[model samples]
Target: MVESFHEFVVHRSPALCRTAYLLTGDHQLAEDLVQTALARTYRHWRRVRDGNPEAYVRRVMYHQQVSWWRRRRLVERLEAELTERADTDHSEATTLRLSLDAALRQLTPRQRAVIVLRYYEDLTEAQVADALGCTLGTVKRHGHDGLRRLRAVAPELVDATAERSTR
Candidate 1:
């Protein structure tokens, strides 16, 4: 463990930034997410120092993100980072990645977080539930609902490959 909270933040911020980016999609929002989570972690540094401080910080980020989304639902959707990148080749993979990102933004915050945690983070359903401080059934429902919403918005994002992998 790091000797101080500042040391811990300096060491882990980059990774936390990446996780925040995955959770929020937008780069700026990802930075804000990391800042806020770290702030809370700092506040309880003494208590968390002996345990899994990183997990504590991550849980704070997820809950704070959902709360922020709920409060901001009435505001206009911002897409500062949605513009196409010129560097990427116009391949099917590029288009699919872009489509998936856009489609992810359409779901409710809880559903979006559920999808990121379950699929992108490769966390099992029960682990996701634990991380989100929710019940197993809640995680299952959110995963199901998120997938259903994605199918309606971007069917290409879901395919028989996942089904075959399971079945």
Candidate 2:
């Protein structure tokens, strides 16, 4: 267990940032999400420190992301870094990443959360449902719809022949 909130942030911020970025697809929004989540975690530190504090922070982030989405404040901004072609060797990988990012943006916030939590974070349907405060059926429906949209939008990123996990 982490002894201090600072220690927790130091060790976990990178993973939290990755999850936040996956959820928002925007660095600024991702940063904001993580910061807000961390702040909330700090407030409830005593209550959650003995338990799964990271999970607590993540739950806060997911709920906060949904709240931000509902307020129509999640306006995606294109960073200048995206337009620069500094590395030609990694262009293929970059293309695939951008394609996936675009495809994710096509999903609703809930669907995006479901996909990120299920695949990126590698959570089960039940865990994802619990995290998002929804039913398992809802998670499954969002996961199904989200994947179908991804296939339609970016078939190259998602292999059609790849078998999905039974879980």
Give the Cα error of residue 93 in candidate 2, in Å.
Answer: 0.3
Candidate that would win on TM-score: 2
Model 2 pairs whose backbones collide: none
What TM-score does candidate 2 get on C-alpha atoms? Answer: 0.81
lDDT of 2 by residue, 1-167 (tens): 34598899999999899999999888998999999999988988989888888778888999998898888865564442455556655656566677788878888888999999899999899888877778999999999999999888778776623423332
Best by lDDT: 2
Residue 36 alpha-carbon offset, candidate 2, angstroms: 0.5
Worst 10 residues of 2 by lDDT: 158-167
lDDT of 1 by residue, 1-167 (tens): 33698888889899788778867877899999999998888888989988878778878999998888777775434453446678757776656666777888888888988898788778789778877889999999999999999899877667633654687
How many clashing pairs does model 2 include?
Answer: 0
Once fitted onto the true fold, the runs of candidate 2 whose alpha carbons sit more than 4 angstroms away are 1-3, 73-90, 159-167
For model 2, state the Cα shift of residue 50 in Å: 2.3
Residue 28 lDDT (model 2):
95
